[model samples]
Target: MDFMPIFCDLKEKLCLVVGGGQIASHKAELLSRAQARLTIVAPTFNHRLLELGKNANVSLVQEAFSEHWLTGCWLVIAATDDPVINQSIYHCATQRQIFCNVVDDPLQTSFITPALIDHSPIIIALSTGGNAPTLSGLLRQEIESHLSTASLDPLSTLATLAGSLRQRVKNYFPAVHIKHQFWLKFFTDKMLINAVEHHDTLAINVHIQRLLTESGAVSLNENRSN
Candidate 1:
């Protein structure tokens, strides 16, 4: 817990990446995936970086690093091979209170990137707290292999359904214990799981309605509370 794992909403937020090599490109791609408005400051960029810049919200500053680039940036990544430049970037960013990551140099980083699995609405992040990134990647691969398509479908749908039912859930289950029981059933009920597994939207709706209207369900909730 030395490093607090957190997800950021970098959408449209200004992010500066200093360097243009392969590692820099990889970091830039991750930032792009988060929809960060990225500005890359480097004299040269690798081919992948150029390709990514084509479609991504990325700008290229074909010049040497400048401390002025740190102004107004939400975060920064120092991926340059030159330790001097990377250290300069790290110090400047930290002085400005902007979080920074110096690639391969965790001691200089305010944050570390974790191995991620992007299953659309379902995203999993793995980290070794900047101790072993390779281990995190291996763990992510193993976990990804065990995640079946059926499981992903239900989880994604469950997230969506929860959002759609947010207000209804509050209105229908005013009692805190009753609301907890209702959600507990969403995971434990075999019938609901089967409907989600089969991708039967109609059956899912029927099950949800039954859960709401059935007297037995309310009694079960009361029993759980007691």
Candidate 2:
């Protein structure tokens, strides 16, 4: 089967994990970091899981999984070592039309969570479609070495500022074509990339204006040449 790519926003959304073992604990940690309202259901939880749940403010349900436990969740994860239990959780989630993932059981899952690198405001996700998780993890490590803490803050700030500029452009122009050209010009400009890579906020701001001005100049030159 061909691999599919999906990106999700889980902020403040209710997410369920039907296990308390190491696998479930790992998933719970990622969900919590994504700001998902996480709920873990199992008869017992590991101490590490318990401590993380307490610290990261996740709800732990020390009970068996039931249909009632699957109510109103945006997404569900089945991470138990017990295949039968995981299958049950997957079935329940599917019956309710909610998104479900069965860890290490790709065929039974509606979605697969990728190996993630979270640099605040910048997120990188790597996946191998369940074919090779270890390989995926190794690739993630390689990617981490190339990314630094210094790059994210500036990149995110520039992205936000770019959005603000696009919004202002839309308010004035109100044309999809013009808005698209603005984005194309914004992204293709070398100065924007240079400024962001070097974490130069002032240079980024200056380059943004220069790019816009240069785009306008080119447009006018084309009109006159015609």
lDDT of 2 by residue, 141-197 (tens): 998888776756666666677767866666644546655777787766777878787
lDDT by residue for model 1 over 138-206, one digit each (tens)?
999999899987778788877778778778877887778767777777766789788987889999999
Give the range of the ten consecutive residues with the poorest summed lDDT in model 2: 170-179
Q: Over 4 Å off in model 2, which ranges?
A: 1-3, 55-57, 148-153, 171-204, 220-226
**What local lDDT score does residue 173 receive in model 1, on the 0 to 100 scale?**
75
Q: For all candidates, what are the clash counts?
A: 0, 0
In angstroms, what RMSD does candidate 1 have relative to the true structure? 2.7
lDDT against true structure, model 1: 0.88
Global CA lDDT computed for model 2:
0.82
Q: Residue 213 error for model 2, in Å?
A: 2.5
Superposition error at 149 for model 2 (Å): 4.2
